[model samples]
Target: MAAVELTVFQVILLFWSLRTAVSQVEMRCPSSCGNICIPYPFGMEEGSYLDERFKILCNSSSGVPKLTVDGTKLEVRDISVRRSTIGVMFPVVSANCGGKDRNTVVDLEGSPFVFSSENYFIARGCGNLALMNQNQSTIGVCVSICDKNRDSMMASCSGTDCCQTTIPSFLKVFNVTMKGLDDGKGSSGEKQCRYAYLVAQSWINYGSYYSDVGGDSDPYDMRHRDSVPVVLDWGIDERVFESLVKNGSFHNSSYSSTCQFLNPSINSTNQSSTVQCSCRPGFEGNPYRYGICEAGRAYDNYRRKIKAKMAGIGVGVGFGALFLLIGLWWLYKVFKRKRSEKLKKKYFKRNGGLLLQEQLSSGEVSVEKIKMFPSKELDKATDHYNVNRTLGQGGQGTVYKGMLADGKIVAVKKSKVIDEGNLRQFINEVVLLSQINHRNVVKLLGCCLETELPLLVYEFIPNGTLYQFLHDPNEEFPLTWEMRLRIAAEVAGALFYLHSAASLPIFHRDIKSTNILLDEKYRAKVADFGTSRSVSIDQTHVTTQVQGTFGYLDPEYFQSSQFTDKSDVYSFGVVLVELLTGQKAISFKRSEEQGRSLATYFIMAMESNCLFDILDPQVVKQGEREDVLMVASLARSCLRLNGKERPTMKEVTMVLERIKKSENLTVQQESEYDRKEVMGAPWDVTSASTISSFDIGAPSSLDEKPLLHTY
Candidate 1:
């Protein structure tokens, strides 16, 4: 009788699976266009897609069916419902050998599609420099150098006759322009036609697709096949679903029943709002269509098999089920612990633990100086990164105040989500900071990589940043003229050491007042080395993506994307201006005529002979007039639009030191003169004359030949 009841239950389960499958089949809509599967959110027919923008068109006029986006010639190659991506054939922008250069513009401004970062901006042809622009700004650039040998020219896309760079995420409009370098020469000694386009990154891994050509051959041979596969990310805004529900297009219940909404994440690159959706787990088919997503066939088969097996052994298993469950639970706990440890190891490896270990072994990074803290220790110290312990947050990560097991206080920097491409930079910060042993630079205590996000441990700085002290003054600890001057000297000394005194020349690319942390003594300690880069002794500058605070960024570096030691000088110059004026680097509180840039405002004030008008009240009141003018002049020289004209950090450091020494001498003279009067001793005429002459000559000497003149 028990066996008969088990068989009945199995039959009922099979019936339910069949009913579910039949219902899915009945609800299925037109699901294909050409060979591409038209998922519900994207369809080739009316009432099948989520909206009009999701519509696709099928054309079979040429004896071969092709799927295209509605009202556009762009052909759809593949659709990924799960990843919310689509592969499309995009035209390659070609520049003819001698004809006017051609540029390709793909506008998806109002659509739900964005050029995925997985696509590479590829440029083919020797002596070609390709630029991908958005809103008239160069976002991506690659240069292909000429290779004399024809065989070597077509070998790879490693900047020899071909080059590629990753595109930015959330890129809706792609504009590619290719320019010839050195008269567009190629291996054949003629202007070769260049091809530039956005292609799916995976497609390039398949191998070389371009054919070698002779000198006399037509440069437009690849014109016959004009398009390359490009990947595009697609997503619908959550507001669209809310609008649909309000307009009675779909019931609120149908939303989650068909499609699962993903957790919204802020895309810092574009600041655009887009929400992704996919079919619920265990279901397959059109997620945007109600009742269309059903249990996968494989899942249904597995269920059927499980029911059959259970029917055969149900009575025997029931007698020992409780003991088996308890035993299984114990095994699961052990398995889970092992899995957790394995996952931590995986994260550590992924975060470049092996590379760091190699550096340590190779003596590139001193092993004795840096430690690798356990994730659990940091977690406990920061109270599991509680909000109350949060020190500060920035574009790269958040800093939390924490205490170690040894009763030592530290700052824990928890980085934001980092992709594989940026892992090198993350490890780079570790290596760079480990090599640095300067007193004015924040010390790297260690790092913990056995967590989801890498954590950097740094020496805690009690006093906040120079920016806060300058802009938001604390009555208890006012940034007096002496303190500001001392802080300036300390920061300049640190930068000079980085530029000329370090084992390897390091560039603090993101130098700003905010990055300048103050210690308990109000001395400057340059912090935040995440964006710093070290270069070889012979290298003058590093050509890279433009990065820095807007107003503090070197104009020359911004225009050319070449960061030099002088670029740091330019940023430091802005900090100097901030110290003098006590104004934000980029502020709208000033007049439009000043252009809202503190550097520009300061320069204008100096040029107009109104330097004291915009000077910080504290600086003007306590600072010596000659010394203030001298420092102002030094700052102006550093802020020169031309990088070459700016004084080197070493030069700036010397000028500051000279100014400080002169102030010290003046203070000593006044102290000695007061002591003589207090004791009623006979004043030495030579000493009084010496003091008078020194005071009289100092300002004139500084004005006639500025201290920065040596640079």
Candidate 2:
């Protein structure tokens, strides 16, 4: 019957389609996985390609498939069958600069094996500041620093935890030098060591090359040193590449539909760079995966299942049949999602995120205490971190309060600037902060980096700043004497931990009253670590660009372009002066004698035995004259002219703790203290100029809304 003939015809069509799908020509991979095919010029070796230009090699030591450049095992995070070539992450380079005392050099040689011009180059860190020579020439370079550490934000690089800069386009290989500006974080080791290196942009996730590389990271067991991963781009000539992908390969059932090759030019040329390809609609696989069309996109267990369904439907419905159209649509979507996820995984690994996790655990850190949030989750939590939701802001970024899925409250600090240089520094801060578990320091709960600007999630502190109480008269308050002393003692203890107890040494270069945060219970929480510098005990401070808040910055360190633990001491001394007099650090007001320098003023007051004359009346009323005098003496000592003469944070902490204990005992004896009744004079804050004399332009106020959406 006619119906029987129709079924037979359908069978014939189905057979033809299957034949077309399987009859694909053998296309080589860029390289090989064992004996398996690695199509075209990207062969296992030179002979595998038309010329040596596209040569590739395998590394058996990888245990699984891996690609290498010249013999260096280039960690192939992924190979896109859709987009030819692969993503090979390189090790990151960190620079440690001594002050401008000498012209020391740290050579970076990625010589013969050139990075791809099509992709990007990234650099990161403070201390390791330099200008890079891309393609053997000065393309561009950046210098980053953080003035204060211990605040959740505020560092030399930005007001945030880290800073970043992007590499120039078309860079093949690069070099670094300390020519343009000098790094002074290496204040102590000014003679011998300084750091600099060229890194692939991919290696630095954010806040990458932190100075605290010694006992806090992967190379901790060894002597003090820090290394990070970097990424680079690669490509073959565009024309040949196009032919390889768009030749009589996939979808060209007939030779007529295949592309025609162009005649070679009448010149000596390998013609490798100018190649690309084409494909038909509803198709998304390499044109030369098998050197021709193949049955599936990327082959894996999951894809096999989808292919099986496709094949089964092909077997039953035949070609040109809409009978299984609905199933096809859904399958396509699933396939696309899987492909995207695979790419993300590839980027994640290439970014060394996986390695970081491994290292954190090996270092005996409780990795579970830290969480990695998906980019989208954070976007929603803060209204995509809307400007309206931002409660405060600073140099590197902005802060918005967010609620996580676990019902945890957090303050999300988001950066406005994102580039290659600070990318790694950002990642480094995240890793370092995640490992630290301090009660007095604001906790770094988690982070999200997939977004353009980085976002750090911290336990939110609702009480605002110790500055607000000392200065702002919002009727919301003036801190009580007990509250002030407790805050000072707690902050001192935290600083002590940063100096000696923590695994690595952290220097808070820009310490000030505003940077000190208070919790709802009035407990002190030392916030911001952006301008902080970490140094190994063996190494001196790294030379860095002059960076820090104007009034709170160390005068000796700034002039000398050097940094030290004592640098933090000098800055903290300025903070003490604020507490004693309720005065700003660098006010343009008051008599010259009172305003010459807070340090000078305090010293003069102490030497003249006029300490009581300058003490905040509220402070004097709240404590006995002897107790007030005792605290004032300590403050004066903290403001010593010589950094070496200033007390160590540990010693400072002991002194303050003794004072706190004595004050608390007195409160207990009196048993009639009322926190709500008495208060100090309204704080005479010497509001710092928003623009430091060194900065290019005025940065946005930390309290105003951001120019862009917080999201």
Candidate 3:
């Protein structure tokens, strides 16, 4: 009787503990809000929440309760505990006819919340450019053209009548501005209203805009929709997790919970780091609650089966069944792995992986430096190369932003499928780029060939291309003369290094402003080596098909089909012209006499002694007359009719460096003079002196000789 009672007590105690663990999630918390069940980590009342960030306010003023973010008053549509995101009905802005234009700005700074990466900046209506900006810098821009065929807009926010672009994560604040590209009239012959908003990825589909209206009608109703759902991410401070984990106290604090550090390279408003808490593998529940993680249904069922087998049969029979089950599981895993390997091998051969291996082994490329990544790993890093992960797209391919397993952010280039003629050239690029290393050149991190088409990974650059800074009117800061000069010198130096410093001479046939990237400090990084060529020591030039941008292409190369190192000089000269004049390399808007080519117009202006007439006002204001003339003269020399007449990249690099040093010295002297005046001047005289300094600092036209005569 005593043994039976003891056994019964032990069984009861185990059952009570299990029940308590599962019930912990709802203890002292309001489990429901209206019709929705509130989960752990997210609570309606004060004491139930793990922290203030988890507080979900229920507004009952209208006789019906509605969920809102605590203190923000932003209405919440839904909460996703698994995704670590919240769906909120964010307001959308519109520029409509017969009504005032509205700009919707969402500022999330100083809050623990951030915009989710899965969200997109979407714009609706035809002939509009939607711009999203933060901290006076443009984040994303999308242009919508007038489309009479609204069928395309019905399916997705395709770049026809509607446009969409993915926003980067860790964005605390952003403002949406919509401007008309047409004369305020859409292709539907209506006074089109532009609507722009931030919305969740899942909520968008074909029927969102054009279901009611066929290909001819307007969707905005001329009044604009009030709001749409957008996703926001939340996380805990990393310091707390680090402190608890390091002291071995985390295990005691929470059972079946794991700490996952957010990618360090991701942008964040928080001063410290952030981390996410998740239920351990084989368990599922809210990890924010203590001891709430429960075993998965499959695991619980398996345990019950084992207990039943042990109770009903002999120990030997039960053991034999368990061993057989384990053997079957092992075999299944082996078969799955073998199948995966066979697929990888098949893809490798199809993507010219064997040819790449042969080339790398020939001693041209350093195998250690140039990694060959598995396709699976890249797919995981880039979320299976989803369109939302795209960084930029060009003629060669699209570049997607990805985070490696080692926590490095990279730009993965997914090239379009190529014909057999281009296969050798693609492999050649990998070998050449892997061997060359220069500061201004984009660094190739690795490549992956285990797919139908190859992928190349390069270090991610944050700031946009030089063309954007020059051409984008929404750009907050104007490109200064000093910055342009420095960039010119940097680009010239990079080209020189490619030609002379590398083992084999390399010609960057696609040397244009668009291919040049700018870092945070505005340092130039020459990129896009898709059309580059590497010649052997004995070769002077490679005669190939005419391949280059029209305005920047060398006349000699275009006429003769021969590409020499000087061909790059002509392209570089065009970039220099763009820097001097803020005009595009090619523009159809220019008059017939002005010529389509910026180089031709610039030369004509110089010959006519009207160089200053076409120069950028910013450059004219900041640049010294002599420095401007010297750069113009160098550009003219580079744009010579004959390739042989063009100055070598080495000589061009030397002149630009000299000019940069001279400018630096002049700036230093001016700064010193200003400092002395500030230190020595009386309070009354200071203001007067500052005003006089500005008056005296203006450039004089008489400071240099004629640009045509100078060269």
In terms of TM-score, which candidate is strongest?
Answer: 3
RMSD of 1: 24.1
| Tens-digit per-residue lDDT, 1-711, candidate 1 | 444467667777776777587567645646665556677677666877777778777775532224334245677878787688888888778877455455657677657777887988878776888888877778789888786675642435677777878887677777887777873432342357777878787766644433332331323233445677889888775678667667655444542235445432323343346666555665565454432354565566666777788667765677457567557767887999899899999999988888778877896544466688999899999988976698888988999999989999999999987888888888889989888889999999899999989999999999889988987799887889988888889999999999989888999999999999998888899989888999989888898998888999988888778888888998999999899889999999999897699988887776566778889999999998767766776787688775655667877787787678777466444222232221233323222221222232332212222212122
What TM-score does prediction 2 earn? 0.45
lDDT of 2 by residue, 1-711 (tens): 344347556765655554455334224334556554555535565466544544555667653444544444554544544444355544434333323232222222222123443333332333334566643556665554433353432222231213345655434444556422234454432222334444434333234534334334321111132333344433334454455458532333422122333232212223222333333432433554333433433233344465576678669875456635656656877899898677666655544456566767686443556677787788788876765587787887899988878877889988766555655555666666765667888899887654556678899999888787777634556666666677777888888888777777777666888888889898888777776777776754656778888777776677777777767877887887788778777766767867556677776666655676877767878866545655565565566555544566776776676667666465334222221211222111232221111121322331233222211
TM-score of each: 0.49, 0.45, 0.50
Query: What's the CA RMSD for each of the models?
Result: 24.1, 31.2, 23.4
Ranked by lDDT, the better of candidates 1 and 2 is 1
- Tell me how far the alpha carbon of residue 603 in candidate 1 is from the true structure, in angstroms, after superposition: 0.7
**Each candidate: what lDDT?**
0.74, 0.56, 0.72
Question: In model 1, which residue pairs have backbone atoms overlapping below 3 Å?
Answer: none
Model 3: per-residue lDDT, tens digit, 465-491? 998888873357789999999999999
The total number of steric clashes, by the backbone 3 Å criterion, in model 3 comes to: 0
